[model samples]
Target: MSLRNNPKKSMKLPLTTRTNQVVRRKLQQSSGPFPRQSTNKPQRRPTRIRTTNPMQLLSNPAPNDRAEEQRKLRMAQNRLSSRNKRLKRRQLSRVAKIQHTSR
Candidate 1:
C-alpha cells in the first residue's frame, strides 16, 4: 500500500524522488546563474624595459658582483648566528627546567 494510506507510515517516510528533485532545482535556481563565470583571473607581470646604456651596463658588473658577494656572505653569517642563538635559548630553557624540577 502507498504511504498515504497509513498516516503513521506517511509521517515516517522520506520525501519521494520527484519531490527531492523539485526541491533541488528550486534551491539551485535561488542560489545563482546556470553558467557560473570564474571570479579570479590570472595576473600578468609588468614587462621590464632595458633602457640602460650598453657601455654603462658593461662597466657596472664588477661593483654589482662585489656587492652581491658581500650580501651573500652577510646572509650566511646571520643564518649561522641565528641558529646558534636559538640553540643557546633552547639549552637555557632545558637547564632551567632541570633546576626547577630538582629543587
Candidate 2:
C-alpha cells in the first residue's frame, strides 16, 4: 500500500510544520500597501553644543567618575599580587636547590 493511502502513518507529521503552513497562509493575505496619513508633526529642538575645551572637561570630572580610578587600583593590586607570587615561587625553588646541594 502507498504511504499517501495509509491513514495511521500520515498522522505522524511534526506539529511545527503544520503551524508554519498556517502562519504562511495568514501572512500572504495581509501583504499589501499601507494607507496614507497626515505628516504634520512639530520639529525637534536642537541640542546645546559645549564650547568648553575637552582638556578642561577632563581636569574637572563629573561627580560619578570613580569607576576609572577603581579599575586602575584593581589592576595595580592584581599586578603586585602576581609579582609577589612569582617571587615566592622563585625563592621556594632556590631554597630547595640550595638544600639539595648542601646535603
Candidate 3:
C-alpha cells in the first residue's frame, strides 16, 4: 500500500527553476480574472417600478388653465385606463386557466 520506498518515485523536482518558469509562462498566457469581451462591456441591473397615484390626482382639483387641466385629465385617464386593462386581462387569463384545468 506504500510507495515511499519505491525506486521509481521522487519527491523533489530535478529542474524546479525551469518548472517554475514554465508554470509562470502558462499563467501569464491564460486570460486573467475575466474574458476580454466581458471586461469591455458592463452589465445592467434591473430598474424599479415607476409610481403614480390616480386617487391623489382625482382628489386634487385641476388648475384654472383650461389647456393644462385638459392635459392632466387626459394623462390621468390614460393611466387609469391602462391599469384597468391590465387587471381585466389578468382576470380573463385566470378564468381561462381554470377552464382549461377543469377540462
Rank list by TM-score: 1, 2, 3
Decoy 2 TM-score against native? 0.39
Q: Write model 1 residue lDDT over 1-103, tens digit each, in one string.
A: 8876887876665578658877788878776634344345457899655447877655555667768878999999999999999999999999999999999
Clashing pairs in 3: none
> Candidate 2 at residue 75, lDDT?
100
TM-score of each: 0.41, 0.39, 0.37
> What does candidate 3 score on TM?
0.37
lDDT winner: 1
The regions of model 3 sitting more than 4 angstroms off are 1-64
Across 6-29, the per-residue lDDT of candidate 3 in tens digits comes to 645443446886588778888799
Q: lDDT for every model?
A: 0.77, 0.76, 0.74
Give me the candidate number with maximum TM-score. Answer: 1
